[model samples]
Target: MGKTLDNVYKHQSLVYKYFLYVVSVALIVFFFPKGGKFKYEFQKGKPWQYENLYAPIDFSIHKTQQEVEEEQSTIRTNKTDYYTYSSTVVSEVRAEVSNGINTLFQTEIFTSSQRESLRNLSEEVLTDVYDHGIFQNMPQSRGTVVVKNNEAQPIAPNDYQNVELAKKAVTEYLSDANSYGTDRLSGIIRNNLKANLFYDNVLTESALNDELSKISYTRGEVDQGKLIISKGEIVENEDFKVLSSLRDEYESELWMGSNYYFILLGYTILVALVLIMLFLFLKRYRSDIFLNNNKVTFIFFNILLMVVATTLMVKHYENFVYMVPLCILPLVLKNFFDARLGLFVHVLTVLILGFVVPNSFEYIFLQIIAGIVTILTASELYKRANLFISVGQITLIYIVGYFAFHAIHEGNLDNIEWVLFGVFVLNGLLTLFAQPLIYMFEKIFGLVSDVSLLELSDTNSKLLKELSDKAPGTFHHSLQVANLAEAAANEIGANAMLVRVGALYHDIGKMENPTYFTENQITNVNPHDDLPPKESAKIIIDHVIKGIEIARKNNVPDRVIDFIRTHHGTTLVYYFFKKQQELDKDADPANFKYPGPVPFSKETAILMMSDAVEAASKSLKNPTYGIIDAFVEKIVKGQMQADQFLNANITLKEIEMVKKVLKQKLTNIYHLRVEYPE
Candidate 1:
């Protein structure tokens, strides 16, 4: 049991890596829609590429979205308007007219015969107006109106009388009376006549909705085993509708039964394969990241974030899928790592998403192209303009690619969705968030980016300024080394920014004992003259340690701190060791060496070479071109013999390149003019 526990502890890192792979795969698969994919691919106005397809099951032919919208629009335009007829209003108006006529007659305004004639004419006018059904608010246009009384009845637009029409009818009836009180009688009838019909908004909307609900989404049905379309046949309007319906039905019903587990298994295997590809890529091209569990987790976390975001958008708002800023993945990765790894990871992520997004071919193509553009155009993210330009280029590509696909599908640019271009632009704007995201990742992961490197490389920074004030000679040495290392890094395709920053901070430990070092000695007095050889050696070795402490206190990232740790790389402090050996025959050599883990990357290794060569070149009395070249060669050769770069992932060819850069730079610095032959 003890041995078994020991084995588990020994392989804990491996076990953790496998656990990450499993968890990432499981989470991604869980978010995927649990529907079976359609077995065939077809596009409207394009030839069917697959074999002839037949309906596997009996299914109703569903209408296209455009077709359904047109039907609904037609229904809305021609729907019947409903109005309610008020019987109580008619009775009240009739009684009021009769009462008014009686009151007028009691005043002796009319003779008995005139009073009788007025009452008869008023009653006749009231009956005629009520029969026509005066409307409280008439319809704006002539159309069929359903009037609900005891039972709902359809009425023509002319059948309903408005107030003006009823008043005209009353006036005409009075004119026919030819009585003394015709005008007064007419006024009584017209004033008492109130509109009995009113528009019924609630009933109208309800009836309209009923009609809309009755709209048939399915036009016809296709029977099982019926040939839907032949191979190489152009998918026209009718064929496209039938094919779409079958695809929908097949996917929806395919996973409803015992086939669900199979579908889930299929999804799991595909997700696992894609993740495995990403793992293999890191292991093959970026082994440094693959070995560190934290870095590995960082990469996987980014992938999962994109997948979750895209899946949620698809599930809730499928039409807005283009709005997601997928290119941000490549942008962030390229800033943190390199362009190659960024594009690789981006492609793998898009491939996984292709399984879920609509138009698998189009989605994968657009995303891959955008990833390429990000890699090609986005550089120096510390500059704000570069990010904006890159995002604009990516958005433009999206618009152009989608336009091309749309034109291909529809055979014209007439039906292109202009709103989708806005979505693409929004996508570009969202991609601008990658810069802040990179800063946040650096903090969370304890990693440094080019932006951070650029910030640290500033000589006017607090730590560098203190180094300048306390140890001006060492600060100058650091600046020279920074220049040399940056030039060499650029020549060999290494991280020039990182190496430059590392070179600037590598000698910060010298600030602790500024006068003890030769470079800081501005006076004739030498501090080393008062100290023992062993103590001088100890002080020299302590700088690397002191630099680390100061950097951490200043909240420097671990990546930069690595430079201070391994710049000396376990090499012997030869001057003090030789002096102590002359004094004592048997002196301890272990105390004279700088404790180091050695440079383990190209950038750090370049710093080590540049730091040693640049400091040693200052001792030349009368420098010449050949002398300076040989001197640079000797220093680099000595360091190589000491195996100071044993752990660094640098090649012999790259070392030769660095030597050439250093040689040219030293000759330039010393002004070693070539001799002219007269």
Candidate 2:
């Protein structure tokens, strides 16, 4: 039991790494649609690239979506409108008319005979209006409509009199009967008349749906072992429809019953292989990131996020698949890491996504190209215009690549999908969000980005400004170091922005006691002269500790604070240590050394070289090209011999490159140009 627990504790980090890998693969595969992938790739109007395909089993050829929709639309447009004749409404209106006339005649302005004549005339008008049928409202169809009473009958548009027409007929009939009060009788008839025809919505809808249901989704059938298409044959309209139908049938039948588990197993293997490739890449080239579980988690989390988003988009909004901002993956990664890793991860992500998206080749091609553009152009993310320009370039690449694919597929520009161009534009706009996303990721993951480094590098920032005010000499020294380190980093393809930021804040602890440091001692009196050698060494060594405390108090990222701890590495303060050794032969050397964890990255390593070279060059008198070159080489070689860079992931070749850059920069600083031979 003791041995088992020991083994578990010893390999816990390895266990956690594998746990992340397993979970990422599971989540990605879980979101994938449970359908078998069709092995062949094809496009409308493009020639078949594979061998001749044959139907392995009997399947029907389905109609295209356009054909199906057109047929349904034709049915709806020509569907017959239905109207119902309500005899009950006619009966009630006629009875009301009779009662209204009798009540009006009771006013006694008319004789018995005059009353009789008005009642007969009113009856005749009502009969005429009712015989022609007063419809409830006009039908939508202008053609003849089917009217249902006890049975159905087709009625012409002219056969029916709506309420308006019925009222007009009543008015014209009583035009010559003014002596019998034409206005009074007309009002009574118009008020009593009601439309007896009403539209039958239920019957019309049923009939239309019945016609639509009769539409044949499948137009033809392919027998078993029949040739579908030959290689090099252009997939015309009919061939496209047939091929699409076969693909659907093939996938549906392939991923059913016991075959489902096998298909799932196949998917798991493919997904695992892709993720394993990513793991291998990080392990091989970026072992620093791989060993740090938090960085590994951050990378895996981004990959999973992109996969889930694309899976949901493809499942729900397949038509707008191009609208997804896939290029943001490389953009964000490039800002946080480097271009090579970003593009590598982007390509891997796109390859995995190819399993879920339709037209896998085209999607993979477009996304990989856009990702390459993203890595190449998305430099200097702290500058808002750079991101904007990068996003624009990415958008242009997407549009151009898609246009080329479309031209290949359709053999013309005439049928290019203009809406996808708008989708590409929208994708570009969403990519602009990568800047804010980087900020959020920094806060959540405790990682730093170039944008944050840019913010920290600002000379007007609170901590930097305090450093400038309290120790102007140290602040100027930091600035010079920043320029030197930045140039060296750029020369060796390291993170220049990171090295610059580190250099600017490396010596902020000198602000704690400005007078003790030689750079800030403006007057002739040296503060160190009065102090004991041991005490002076303590003060110089305490600056690194003081700088870390100040940075933590000011909420500086730990990545930047690493510079303060590692700039002098484990090297001793030679001036104070030598002074102490001369007074007593038994002085301890521990008191004079800067507490260090050593530089662990190329950026931090570059800062160490730059900080040391820039400070020592101040003591040189009458500097020249040859002298500066030798001086820089001696200082770097001494540090190298002391193993200051033993922990750093830098090559000897890179160290030499940094030395070259520092030498050239120093010569320029002192205005020491080479002399021409006469």
Candidate 3:
């Protein structure tokens, strides 16, 4: 069973999902209708009895090597006696039977006299009823039913594949048995029945023909037939589907149970906890592939979405029902992270949830395609209207799926059209409304989501107003940063709106001490003009750290706080660093630098580099496009080499792309004036 599971899977931990297998089997046992006429219901001696799965091997009956060697020696010694050639050996295992000719012998409980009588009757009937053919002289017993000289013999199920022997056995058994019993046996045989009708007919070959000819015959067309399912076959085939339905219907009820579902659920929780421990110990376990300024809230939302997805799949069935949500997560999570990471998670979830239901192929196929489609459609997240695009894609996908299913699904239309349309609507609502759902969830639960940008843009946001009132310059500077960042982010297909909103609120810390930073102060009499350079640097760098505290206390979104903390990184306060150095030749370069750590994300790095370059470009007294270009390049590279480019998803190539685009925009913003009158 374990080896069979390995063949069907790709990942290892998912082997843990066998818990579902156990739970399913247990449910079958618990829900066994005690008073019903069910078969294969864990009852002893039933073909599909549950005990078969865990039953211990019958090692007690195993033969010793010495016994096996003796058996092999007998087979070699008997080869010439049984075969046309001595070189051939037969591995045909045999069991002692009550007789040779009765294919379905009366069981061992039969009297010895009856067994002998049956054997003798079979030979007597065969001699008078059949003719031997020259081409194939006799049947060899490789188990199953075998015939020699038109007489049938029974063999065990273990060797039934010998077709030549099986055919003669069937022919001989059917010959006289058609009328063997008093006319009482003329009706169809019961499914779970034992019979020797064919064995009885061995001598009367013409009676075999007469029995078959008794049925009506039709000529021109192929005959269609209904397969008669036995009670045992029905119960075995009914299992997995029944178990799947039970899972969807009673998930919460079963999960809360003390034992049956707890084994699987508890193990899942343990795996998660172990992964958490591994995360802390390995440190690198999280694999920094697509982190951004909104790392925590982004991760929180993704994990939240992951759990929601798992629950939905567990609770629902149908190709589109559970499948749609499972596919939506990677796209949703990647809105703040990146599409690549979203695709990765989507693939992982598809493989896991693929097995949650019985017919996994259909659900998994739809899920993986829908997930990739959603990721492409929702590639960038920082917007309000992108939801519409997702909705559109979802609707289109559902339509395509509708047609595919319409042609292939085996069902009556009376039940399917409305359900299919509802699925279409449901998928659209989830995909399009995810952004709003995130917003509402964050607001209600006091959580943070990447969608928090919608709230960050509020001009009446207390921090923005405070910056505007206490330090209009800083407020205006933030607006300019918003414009610049938004434009740069858009040009390269990043989350432009998030960049704008983040830029707007990035300087909220300055509101705590507006005069300490230059952007917040207007008068030429700078605050740093009076203070020592190192002290000024502390106040300047402190805004980022302080902004984080202020944002947290005010219930600002955690994503916004992350932006504030990381935007500056540890890039040096060059002006203060230079002055402190001039004042003391031996002063360490780190003394006047912005307190430790560097920008950890593409969004923050862009903000840090752009915020510095934009402000510095504006102060260039008489800036040229070339000079602006150089300045943007210089600051970006400075931040880049400081290894400040850590968690950001921007490739070096993307940074260069960001640099080229920012230079063009800054050049226009800081355009030189013309002396038209002269």
Which number leads on TM-score? 1
Name the regions of candidate 2 deviating beyond 4 angstroms. Answer: 80-92, 103-137, 143-154, 169-188, 196-214, 586-591, 651-653, 671-678
lDDT of 3 by residue, 510-618 (tens): 8878877766666777767888988888888888787788788877766566668777777788888888888898878786666645655566667776787777775
What's the lDDT for candidate 2?
0.89
Ranking by lDDT: 1, 2, 3
Sorted by TM-score, highest first, which candidate order results? 1, 2, 3
Better of 1 and 3 by lDDT: 1
lDDT of 1 by residue, 62-133 (tens): 997778999999888888777788888988988898888888888866677777777777777787777758
What is the overall TM-score of model 3 with all chains considered together?
0.53
TM-scores of the candidates are 0.94, 0.91, 0.53
Model 2 clash pairs are none
**Candidate 1 TM-score versus the reference:** 0.94
Pairs with backbone N, CA or C atoms under 3 Å apart (clashes), candidate 1: none
Each model's lDDT: 0.89, 0.89, 0.54
Clashing pairs in 3: 129-203, 173-198, 173-199, 174-198, 175-201, 176-201, 602-648
